[model samples]
Target chain A: MEIAQSLQQVKSSYIREILAAASDKNVISLAGGLPDEKTFPIDLMKPTLENLANMPEVFQYGSTAGYGPLLSFLNGYFQLPETHTAMITTGSQQGLDLIARAYVNPGDKVVMEAPSYLGAMQVFGLVQANIVTVSQTEFGPNLEELEQCFAEQKPKMFYAVPDFHNPTGVCWALETRQKVAELCIQYNVAFIEDAPYRELRFSGEALPLVSDFCPQNSIVLRSFSKIASPGLRIGVVTGKTSYLEPLIKIKQGADLHSSVPMQALLHGLLQHNNFATHITTICELYKSRYDVMYAELEKQLPASCVLKPVDGGMFVWVEIPECDTFELAKSLLANGVAVVPSPVFYPEGSAVKAALRLNFTNATPEELTVAVTRLADVLNAL
Target chain B: MEIAQSLQQVKSSYIREILAAASDKNVISLAGGLPDEKTFPIDLMKPTLENLANMPEVFQYGSTAGYGPLLSFLNGYFQLPETHTAMITTGSQQGLDLIARAYVNPGDKVVMEAPSYLGAMQVFGLVQANIVTVSQTEFGPNLEELEQCFAEQKPKMFYAVPDFHNPTGVCWALETRQKVAELCIQYNVAFIEDAPYRELRFSGEALPLVSDFCPQNSIVLRSFSKIASPGLRIGVVTGKTSYLEPLIKIKQGADLHSSVPMQALLHGLLQHNNFATHITTICELYKSRYDVMYAELEKQLPASCVLKPVDGGMFVWVEIPECDTFELAKSLLANGVAVVPSPVFYPEGSAVKAALRLNFTNATPEELTVAVTRLADVLNAL
Candidate 1:
């Protein structure tokens, strides 16, 4: 049978390709965006599981919005303005999918960062949205380019990871965040800010959220996958209720609701003070790992291959001069080290780039050292 | 903030309207299709939750396809044909949505039962599929009507619930089922068989599945929502590997994967011999409730209202001559009972109907008796 034209347009992610090659037992995979398992709050989760087992109500259907208690907890935690309503999602990915469905019309223009998250791009593609990309510059995403895109095409939505961006560990400057929010409101375009790594800061002060700058036009996607657990698939979409109401309705068609027991488990974790304490512990661990990976890269790699300054995110972006990262990635996989090529992050699949994204959170210091050494050897041979 | 044309085409399910009214303390709902919370396997679930507390791996990201052990268990249990591949879904609802994304294109023709599951209709609408309905006749969905539909329009797909269908509680005649399968294969149109209610039968011989007839083109959707716990949201999509491969990739973009802990919990529940015993207990309880409901309708409802014969399944579909079920549903809510009107299930929102779909599984026999009596009184007053 024939596949839908929309689905036919979606390109497979390079991360999956790299991971498939990393399946050999000896390969250390830094390609996929997975949270460290050891950081899971097992002790905090125990009481929640025990309580849920006895309360048979937890095994029944929940409202399409989410479990009431968890929703209430988030309402309090976020100190959400009256303008914004929040609903639990299966994950940030589902949040992106629902936003695509509720807002994106076929052939509608969507503005995204040049090297945006591939997962988000795939979802927008499946809805057949015409995506336009703006490059990330030293100050932030190119504002002149964004202004031109919005002014010329009046895109329906703008998707960004303003803080701790995936593939590239750069946070948008605060002024840039404020300007983007203002532009969205002026152009009558929705702004989507995905912050899976916002809470995982190892250095630097926290920046104001895009939603904070413009409550009515901005929507935020929050996930517990990094700070707490990924397997639970706990996340939320927060925005002005006017914007959020449509998504909640579409979410009903997506999966009815997220797992109720999982929501209750999230509630239990948040009820105690340990939730914040646990996040701090994870940040500390990731910081040390980041330091080790950075040290190794500086010692082994030539200065021509620039390694961007890392502050808070899980990944370190490296620009390798005169090389195709995709071809280089295959050789690195053969050498038992997995890394993601930069082209997957760009909207245009064949856009030229020689950058590699290496994750520092899922691997230990010893493993990072060995992986970097092997990567350097591969580059020298090339 | 203009909504997408695709989303604008979607209509909300009537169950939501009834549920909102049923929130009053005095109201008893026969509206939502929820399993009896009392019948959930709390005892069987306790040890699984306890075991999951220590297995920190449950809190980490899993493969996009599903948990391995659960996949293997289902593969063995289903004894799927060599041509078929299966993957776990967030719920049967997600399964429906993914199938729509994989197969339906904007303006593409889809054929469905006249009074099908509204949740499904909503998903197809979200994708802007041009849906046409064939009425369900006494023996099954009128096969003659379906064949004519296939012949005239060459619909891109046909969605059917052959056994113990929702709302109508009608099973297709053996010949009808075989003919539908043959037609789909002959026309090279995909056949989507939804079997959420298949395992909930209290009486009737098990019939052959559509997948058994046309393994290459038929995609079967299975759910554990009724047989086990809906809160876990475990379901599966089974089809030929060629067809399923694209869906698995799309599933990655949908939510990465279903909750890993929930899959682990489901795996634990299936390991014990009690899984079958527990299902039997649930069937018996629902059977008792169905009997009470069937009896109440016989005693109280006027001859003008016909309650379709229900051998098994949770609902009793009623057709009331000369009364609009939608308008009556409002008056019934005021009189302290809740039910879904039939128009929401039709492809066209304003299609005329005098039908109501009442769920008998969520309430006890005593509650059903009282609820049915109230329903009858409301109908008499109308």
Candidate 2:
């Protein structure tokens, strides 16, 4: 069959595919970056449904930009009163897809941190953008490498997960964030700050969004998936009005709008409950799980294995020296455990293969301990 | 400030934009192709939500292909037991968008009816496809013109709403569907069967889908929005396994997946309730509303105005001689009525300008009567 040339270049989302394959009842899966379902505020949803049922228009199609009330609430929640415009999306993933569709013409240049979120990279790939990657530093993306990539590639946009960055689980320091914002302004490149994990921070005080510093040129994507329910599929995009208007137009042609009932439910939850406090509870839960997983990995894993403690977010990044993570993942799965190989997160055929991402949020403490022991056994056998 | 060249060619959805503008309290809107809110099975949804509450997984991130039970239900409902694959989408609109992204490369040829669904046209435009429009007949798209288009353009695909075709409200006869399917197969052109309005038929038995006639190369998109609840935003696409597999991959990259709670609610509604019987009741309700609007148009419209009595679907297409629908729609709005200008439904700068699409489904009988009378007044003044 003659597939589109662009599709020939496009690969299936690795994390999603691996998670699907390993979702058996016995597997202690760490492949999916899923939020803890146990922490979902089920009691709050009852009142939310009641509120939606009361509103007659809740069942009707909403504005393409989003439900106006939800957008207003998001704007206030983000505390961007003056220069920001917010639009709701199906999820933060859709926000990235919309931005890709709007700004990326075929063969356009887009830069991102190496080993960034696989989903965002998949979106950029679909648009046939030429992806340039900068190395990941302990703080955030390597500033010098980014500057060099910017000068050489002159990319149209830079995509980042500055808040508790995915896979690496390293949040950008306030200084690094300020520097990146200034560089985006200097280079005339658009910045897409994906902050889906910002609210999940457990250790440090939350830093101001990159958008707060570079108000005119950056867009920040936030989702309720981490806090409330991923099943609701609600997210918000906040940015300068000029960029947001175009995104709204793209969204109109995408799905017309996100699910209205879900939007109404989210609005109801926000209005009626202390959603912020609930998110805090979720953070504490994940923090304890992260600690458990980190401690178990240290006690059980081989001396060659290095584990990075996740300050926030769902994943703990692990590096295995001189070992194929993919093979280790398969052996771990055979032993009733699942972990995602990080090589799939890089560009296709890239040289990064020794890293793996293990999710700490989905499994229980006992399960995490068992999974780590199983992983250690697999590593030792290899 | 610089818009993409692709966006320059893409216009806002005429129905959605006009409907938003006509949301004034005084405006008796007959422009939106939205299903009646009163017809929404709200009573059923309460129990459905209760069922969802019992299933903890309903609030978690579901499979990218869909919620498994919903896909299984759809497969059984559509009778695609063999040689078929199904995936859930945000809506049928998103399905079309995915097909466009996956199949239609720049300058790829695509075919549509002369006055087709505006949303599909907008998607094709965004993909930079060269669109060729075939004329329309009462039965459906003109088979002779479609044959000619296939011969001349060799389009990559043809998009059609064979069942109660939008704006025109014309159902394709069985013979027409078979002939069109045969031609597509002969030319190896993909057929996109959009059947959102299929279940809304007021009378006459349902015709077999084009996919039934030619399963090897056709994709069928069905939506629960019209019959059940648009607020849930659940829709499905079924087609040959070969083609659908790639589309499912594209969908995974697009939005991760549709809402899990929405799909769970739909699955519950389908399993626990007599949805077919509910749809029959809805058809009866729409039939009466359709008759009321038809009679009112006959009595109140200008002598020069021509209206084709539609068997099903929400809209009534009307042509007023020597009157531009854009101007007339503005005049009608001033007179506290709303209708969509027909030109917006056509390809860019098409010659079809003197027609309007008045929706009878969304308005009450009294509201329809008053709106039609006001429309007549506007036509008379013009």
Candidate 3:
């Protein structure tokens, strides 16, 4: 059967494909943007599930928007004033899919940071949107390039990670965020800020969301996957009332709503448990792990290897000049260490072939030491 | 902001709008395709949640295809004698959406029943498919018209409900299923047989699905929502190996997968409890409610009212000649009763508008009796 022409353009995430082929006994996987399972609030979750089981209405069909109490809880969490609205989604991924369906038409232009999260690019591609990419600097997305893309494409929307951005672990400075907000206002383009890892910061005080700078044209996406459990599939979208209303409609047309029982479980966890305290402990744990991984890299890697210290988020981006990250990844897999090539995080067939992303969160200190030693051996052999 | 052009072609479900506006306290809602909350296997579910709570792994990220045990269980359910592959989805709604994204391209020909489930129509619209509707008869879709459509349009696929079909309550006879399967095979068109209500048959032995007749060209969808709980949002799809591979990729790209915790809960329910026995009791309860509604309609409806007996399923189709069903629905809503006008289910906006769909599953016998009496009175006044 002839499939959708748009599907011809849909490419699988290269990292995911490589991770799938690696053996559990040998592979030290850093290919997936996965949270450390050890930090999952299982103790809190058990009681939460018990509470949900006791609530008779929790097991039935919920409103197409979400469970009311959960939505109310999210509204409080996001600190949205009475004027703004919030809706819970299956995950941040579903939030991205809903935004695409709601706002993007065929041939409509959508702007994104050049090496942004691959999942969002796949979704925009499925919607048949003409994608325009802007380069990213250590501070954030290149402001000049962003303005140029906005001026040239007049994109229907701009999707970005404003805080502790994925793959790069670079947060947008407050000034850069302000400039982006002003540009959105100037161009009348919607700004979609996805901040799934905001709460995972190890050291600095959190920055204000880009949405706070331009509330009228911004939508902020938050996920419990990084802090709680991805299995529960809990996420929320906060934005202006006008945008949220249509997103709710698109969500209704998607999967009716996110899992109601899961929402109830999450609500119980938030209300009854010391969720903030739990997340603080998790951040400390990840911070220690990141320190261990950083030390291992310094001790074991070649002097030519260069990496920017990740302030927050799960991954550390490493650049090995003139070496193919994909080939290096395969060699590491053979040596029992798994790391994702950087190109998977970029648009299909991008030129960022010399970089690789390593995740420190999912591995233990001993494992990280051994993995880094093996990775150094692979690089030396190359 | 300009929304997607495809959305302009997508019509919001009229039934959803009516249900939203009508007061819950006074309204006898027949507009929702909802299962009886009273009949939900609550006892079975409590233990299921307990079992899931005992296993923390259930609360972590699962394979994109789905949880392994649930997929294996569904494969057994569908492919008893021979092995087949199955993928879990958010709901049967997501199943339709994935199929649309994977198969339909702009202006691609797709066939559906004239007065079909509105959700399916919404999905096809998103993909910009040229939808052709085949008239539905008492036994099933008019095979003659379907063949004519196939000959003329060379449609890529035909979507239908063969068992306890929505609104119409018509199950395709065994012979009709075979003939439709043969025709689809001959024309090399895919068949999507959605069987959400198959387990809810009040009487009669189960007829084999169209996929049973033409295994190579059919994809069968089954859901735990109608039988268990829609809040959990778990559904399964089974088809040939060739088709299953691409769908696995599509499901991965869509939302990673459905909720893992829900899949675990469902697996516990299926294994540890008499779920089939519970469904039997629920079906009998709905059958009683169906009888009560039919008796009330026979006694109180105007002489001009045309009614069709529903053997099983949630709805009853009623036609009132020379009166617009939409206007009648409004009058019924004013009188504190709700029904979905049939025109909303049709593809063409200008199609027949004299019928209304009444659901008998969600209300008690006394409530249904009172609601139908009020409905009859409103029709007489109209």
Q: What share of the true interface contacts does each candidate keep?
A: 0.87, 0.57, 0.64
Write down the lDDT of every candidate, Cα atoms only: 0.86, 0.84, 0.82
The sequence of per-residue lDDT tens digits that candidate 3 reaches over residues A255-348 is 8778888998888888855889998998899899899999888888888878788778898888787766677777788888888877777775
Q: State the DockQ, from 0 to 1, for candidate 2.
A: 0.64
Q: How many clashes (backbone N, Cα, C below 3 Å) per candidate?
A: 0, 0, 1
Predicted candidate 2 versus true structure: per-residue lDDT over B1-382, tens digit per residue: 3566778777666676677779899999988888998888777677876556567788898888899988888888888958888999998889998888888888998899878898898888898988888888888888887888899888899999998888888889899989998998999999999999989989788889987888888998988889988878788999978888888888777788999989888888887557778898899999999999999899988888888888788888887786556777778888999888878878875557478888888888999888888888878766
What's the C-alpha lDDT at position B217 in model 3? 92
Q: What is the CAPRI rating of model 2's predicted complex?
A: medium
Q: Stretches of candidate 2 above 4 Å error?
A: none
Comparison by DockQ, 2 against 3, better one: 3
Write the candidate numbers in order of decreasing TM-score: 1, 3, 2
Alpha-carbon TM-score of each model against the true structure: 0.98, 0.97, 0.97
CAPRI level of candidate 3: medium
Model 1 chain B scores worst on lDDT over the 10 consecutive residues at: B344-353
- Ten-residue segment with the worst summed lDDT in candidate 2 chain A? A47-56
Query: Alpha carbon lDDT of residue B230, candidate 3?
Result: 88
lDDT tens digits by residue: candidate 1, B91-169: 9889998899888888898888888888888888888898888888866788888889899989988888888887789
Q: lDDT tens string, model 1, A195-265?
A: 99999888888888987878888889999999888999989998888888888889999899999999999
